[model samples]
Structure formats: C-alpha cells, structure tokens
Target: MIDKVFPTPDEALHDVFDGATIMFGGFVTAGTPTNLILALQRRGTKGITGIANNIGLGDKLDVLCEQRQLAKMIATFAIRASGARQSLFEEQYRRGEVELELVPQGTFVERIRAAGAGIGGFLTRTGLGTLVQEGKQIVNVDGVDYLLEKPLRADFALIKAFKADRLGNLVYRGAGRNFNPAMATAADVVIAEVEHLVETGELDPETIGTPGVYVDRVVQCEPVPVRWYG
Candidate 1:
C-alpha cells in the first residue's frame, strides 16, 4: 500500500521550485486551495505562472499576487470589476511588471482538460478571428474556421478536496470539484489538501472523483463552511 499522505504542507510541497507553472483549483475563492497556496506563498518561489479562474477579488489575503510571487498569470479573470478591490496582480500587470494571458473561460478549462487527456491541442470556434486567435493556428474544416487552442499542463497542481484516502483517492465536496479533478491529471506533481484523510478502505469507491493514481501527495486541511448557488 502506498502512503501518499504527508505530515505537513511544507513537506508535501517541498519540491516545488521557482519558475514552475502551477494550476490553482477553485471557482474564485469558493473552493480555493488556500492551505497549499499559503505553503507555496511562504516558500517564496518566484517566476510562477498561475492558471486559475481568477487571481482574487482584490483582497489583501492573496499573498501569491500581493507578494509579487507570480511572474505571470494565465487566467480567465485577473482584473477586478468596477468598485471591486484591486489585487496586486492588476497593479503589476498594468505597470508592465508581470505577464497576463487572459483566455476565454471555456477555452481555458478545455485547454487544461486537453493537457490531462494527453491531446496535443484542440480546435474550437470560440476564439475565431478574435484576439485569442492572434498567434494560434487557424484550421478550416468544411466551411467553419476553428482556432487551435493548445493544452495547458503544469509542473504542480494545488487542489482542495473534502476527503482523501491514504491511497490518494479524493472526494471533493460541492463546488470544490470544479477544477480539482482536471488539474490533478494535468500536473506532474499533484498535492491535495483535504479536510479528511481516511484510510484506504474507509472511503466508498463510488464517491471518489479523482482516483489516487493521479495524486502524488495528500495533506490534511480544515474544511471551511461553504454554500453554493445556481
């Protein structure tokens, strides 16, 4: 039996180095991997390229961006809306201090999924003739033009889950399931921060969303109260 469990967040993420690309799992802050993010932030590894739905809702709590830790962010939303708190990422990006790749929401997720699935790239009409198609290839099949969107693999994936068995199988609760599963398969090292760390057989096989084989490390974290809206 493999012991994927780690004693602490630092030990689990000790190997993460500078200039590594990381995929963050969450829908804004709802199911964010706050614990793992904290560990990485403390490590102070620089030149990171973060892939996420958003940087943060312009809050001081976003240490990764606030501390100038990321060299770039490949996300759907890095800038906040009017009257929203402004995050440090926006400040840096606007001053030409950092890089930003703003992908269309659907295209961004699909790219990550494609990487995990081992596909080179996929063609989509989502960004045809738009800024998203600028440097990408354009393929025409029949009469429709599709933009070639590349896969988005990462060196590490930090995900928050509800429960994880010793074998690394994970069960995410509610909204946490959003990007965790996909990012799990897309990264070389997947360190999961879960609320509950159970023994192998303690978990019901049917409830697992991310199989253990895809996860390399698991750390226990306290589950926070969360509510979802449709």
Candidate 2:
C-alpha cells in the first residue's frame, strides 16, 4: 500500500530533465496525460523525444510542439488531416527544429513490447517489402521475407489512466489503454496521471491492467479540455 500520489503535476514530474526520451500513451488523444503534458509545457524542458501513436490533434499535445520543447517525435501518425494547428508540427519540421520517424501502428506497439520484454530483436513480416525495409536488415525465414526490427526503450513513460490506486495500480477505460500498457513496461521510469485516485485495496486485483511495479509515480489530474475529439 505505497502511497505514490504527488501534490502537483510538476512535483510528480520533478526529476524529468531536458533531452529525455519519453514514451507517451494515448491513441489520437483519447487517453492522453493532459495535465502532465501541460506540466512539461510549463516546466519548459527542452530536447525531448516523444514516442506515441499520434502527435495529438489541435491543442491536445500541441503545447510541446508549439513550445519547440520536442527535439523529435516517433509515432504512427505525424500530421493532422486538416490544416488548423498544422503550423505547430509543420513549422518545426520545416525548420529542421524537430525530427519525425513514422512507423506502422502494429510495428510501433511490438517494438515497445519487445524492448520491455528484454528481447534482443524480433523478425516481422509487416514491413518486409516496403520502404520500411529500405534501411533495415532483412532476413528470410522458410523462404518468407521478414525484417529484423530493433527494440525501442525510453527514459520515461507518461501515461494516463481512468483510475489508479495509492499503490499505483492502474486501470484504463476504453481505447485510452492503447499505448499506455506497453509504454509502462518499456521505460526506465513511469509517471501516471489519472482522473481518480483510490485507496490501495479499492481496486480488484483481477481488474488492474498495470501493476504498481512498473509505475514509479502518480498524480491526480483535473478534467482535461476535451475538444471535438474528447
């Protein structure tokens, strides 16, 4: 029953320094740690490498990109469809202020998982014949083509949860759970922000999606500003 709650988002992320590689959870902004992202924005930490499903839409995770705090982004989707907030990410890329590495969604998740599991490398058929194999090593297994993919690890993992126990056990609701769980195990440290915080025994053991062992810190966040996406 370790109480991991911090007084504020800034306090929870106190040790996060500049030039950190961060794995951010949420699929297209549904389960993003809005408060934590805001805290990082306010803290003004620079040279961050963010790994996520999408860079977020509109002002969702735009704080970092807008502030130029991000040095690079590793994600499945790098740009928005329409042109509203496009300037934020686009300007950075145009000026060579930020670097972006796009990967297939399935490859993205598996790479994180592989790193977390301590596997050296994995062979996948997902990107065997496309541009993904261009700069990568390709291997043949039983006459089938597969790419030898490297694992991805990070310095910190920022995740959002629907509910979290005092011990840092977490449960994510709906699609919010996407990259959070895999990011949880793949980083050196994990900071979780949740809407609800409960006592240690409040959550059922079988229901906990992320155990306390992988999470190092927790903070209770206010309702995030939900725009058209929510």
Candidate 3:
C-alpha cells in the first residue's frame, strides 16, 4: 500500500476543491488543524461549507471567515462565544452573504455520527418547540414527538492529533480528542495533522483513537502551546 504520510499540510489538502463541504475537528481551538487551515486560506478556494464545533475563538476558522473563503457554516456555536466581539462569520451572516446552520451541540455531533454509521437520520427533541425546529419533520414515537435531524457528512475532514503512526493511526491529547474521531469517519477524505509522527508500531493498538482506515493522509505540524493556568 502507498504511504499515507504527506510532506506538508498543503499537499495533504491538495485535492480539496471549491464548494466542498469540510468538517474541522476542534473545540475552542484546542485540537484545530490551524496549519492546514492557513494553507487552505492561501489556496483561495471559495464557497466552502464548514462543519465544526464553532467558527473558532479568534483562531483557525476565523481567519477563513475573514477571507470569505467559507460560504456557509453548520456548527453548534458560531459568534456567541465572542461576546462583544463579532467574528467575520457574524458580519457576513448579518448581511445575508453567508449561510449558517445553528445546531445544538449534541444534535450536531449526532448528525455526523449518523452519517458515518450510514443511518438515514435520527430523531431528537433537543430543538423541539423552538426556532431550531423550523422546517424539520416532526415524528411522534410512543406518544412523544421529536424533530428529525439529517446526517452531516462532508467531502473533506481536517483533523488534529497529538501523535500518529506512519500508517495514520492517531492518538489525541486531552480535550483535543473532542471531535476528531467522529469527523474522521464522516468525510470522504480525512487528512490528519499530528505533532508527533512515529513508526507504524509505535502507537498502542488500544490507545489509537482514530484508526488508519479512516485517515487518507497524514502530515506533521508544529504543536500548539498549551496554557494550563490561564
């Protein structure tokens, strides 16, 4: 089999096209593929639909929004985390220039999981009787009504991990593990960036969060400086 490792982040993302749907693995920027995102911003691909926990907290996804590279965002949290400071995504959304799909966190991840599992959709009451329920089909099961949330698959998935074997098995650190595994399975192409690249047998089989089967490409990237007591 051909090696899954790539020499650089841009090369890993070389096949990503304009108007592609992408899932970014990160929660509050802790496990984001910042380098790959930077390369993507430089690539100038437009009309991108991004699926992530948020637009970012002054991090990776925000820069993409500033460039207007992202045409739409399907996320649990968007600009609300910024408090008084609005992100570029919010500005574009306010002007009716970008499409936004605000989903509850649980439902958002569940939708992606459904896609990966080959399930049509799932029923959830998370957004019941709220604006989030709009346009969604409601089904009553056992006398309880729930809204149908469609699966959320993507064309490309950009994931981050602390360590990876040459074969692409991944090991995420702490909170960095949040969305990477699920996103990996939900995309047609998954490129994982790792801080540590080791031989194929280095990673303990049981500790690998994402197996090589789900990763198409792997690249080594500079590690993010973590602040523990901020």
Candidate 4:
C-alpha cells in the first residue's frame, strides 16, 4: 500500500522545474486543478509550456499568464467573454513573448491519451478541411481525408478531483470530470489535488475516475476564493 499523500499542494508539486512541459486538467471552470496550478504560479518557475482545454475561468489560470511564468500555451481556446480575461494571453501572443498552439478540444484529449498509452501517433479527420491540416501528413482512408496528429505527452500532469483516497484513486464531481482523467494518464508524473481526501478503499471502485497507478502524489486543496469574471 503506497501512502502517496501530501498535506500541501506545494509539497506534491515540489519537484517541478523550470522549462518543463505540463498538462493541466480542465474544461473552462470545470474540473480544473486550481490548487496545483496556483502552487506552480507561486513557485514562479519560468518558460513553462501548458496544455489544457481552455485558459480561463475567473481567477483560475489567468494568474499564470499574467505573471509571465508560461512560455507557451497549447489549448483549444482562451477565454474571451469570461474567465480570467484573455487580455493577458492576447497581449503576450501579440508581443510574441508567448507562443500559442491552438488545438481542437477532442483532438487535444486524444493526443494526450495516446502519449500516455505509448502510441506513436494516430490519424484523425477532425482537421481535414482546414488549416489544422497544414504541415501535417495526410492520408486517405476509405476515401476520407485524415491528418496525422502526434501524441501529446507531458513532464507533469496537474489534475483536480472532487475526492481521492490516500492511495491516489480519484473521483471527480459532475462537470469536473472533463479533461482531468486524460491528463492524468499522459504525464510522466501525475500530481492530484482533491477537495476531499479519504483513506484507501474509501472510494467505490466504479466511481474512481483515475486509478492510483497513474497518480504519483496527492494533495488536499483548501477552499478556493471566489472570483467573478463578468
């Protein structure tokens, strides 16, 4: 039985270094690993590359971009109407201080999962009709255009969950079940931050979103402060 538990978010994320590539779990405000994200920001490590579904949701991840700790961002979208205000992201992109790699939401998840599974790459028709196909190998499968998309692996995966056991089995609550599971599988090291921490076997087997095998560390997150994006 592995303890795999940490009292603080900072401890769970202690070994993250500068210039590392990280995959953050979330789909906007839902299931975002905010505690670990904040700890990373507070660490002030620079030149980081992050992959997530989106980059805003009130006070959530916007802080990272504002501090310039991020060197590049790969995601589907940056919040324009809501969340942490994409002003920082837009400013950085325009100045060329930060690079952005836009990806389709579904493809992003698949790429990460493929990386985790040790697969080289897979073909997809998601970007067949647009610029997403540019610079990528194209193949015809059953007379349909498919683009070759590479797997996405990360040095660290920051995942959030509604609950977890000391052994690192995770259970996500409702909308929080978006990208956290896939991100968890795709990282060399997985750090999980949960709102509620329980003893081993406390969580039902069927309810676990991510198994302990993928998780390396666990942290109990404190209540997040409320911030309005509107």
For residues 72-98, write the lDDT of model 4, one tens digit per residue. 899888636444445677677878888
Cα lDDT tens digits, model 2, 1-230, are 47888979999888899999998888766788888988989999999998988775633566797778999999888765565556577667868878999898999999999999999878999977788788998888899878998899999998999999989999989888898999999999899999999998999999899999889899998958765442
- How much lDDT does candidate 1 score? 0.84
Taken over the whole model, the C-alpha lDDT of each candidate is 0.84, 0.86, 0.87, 0.84
lDDT sort, best first: 3, 2, 4, 1
TM-score: model 1 vs. ground truth: 0.93
* Model 2 deviation from native, Cα RMSD in Å: 1.8
* Local error of candidate 2 at residue 37 (angstroms): 0.3
Q: Give the C-alpha miss distance for residue 212 in model 3, angstroms.
A: 1.1
lDDT of 1 by residue, 115-167 (tens): 99999989899978678889888999998889999999999998889999999
Off by over 4 Å in 4: 79-85, 226-230
Separately for all candidates shown, the number of backbone clashes (residues 3 or more apart, or on different chains) is 0, 0, 0, 1
Expressed as tens digits, the lDDT of each residue in 1-230 for candidate 3 is 54799999988888899999999998875888888888899888899999999875644687887778988899888766336667788878889988998899999999999999899999999999999999999999999999999999999999999999888899999988888899999999999989999988878898999989999999998965533221
TM-score of each: 0.93, 0.94, 0.94, 0.93
Q: After superposition, how far is residue 29 of candidate 1 from its true place, in Å?
A: 2.2
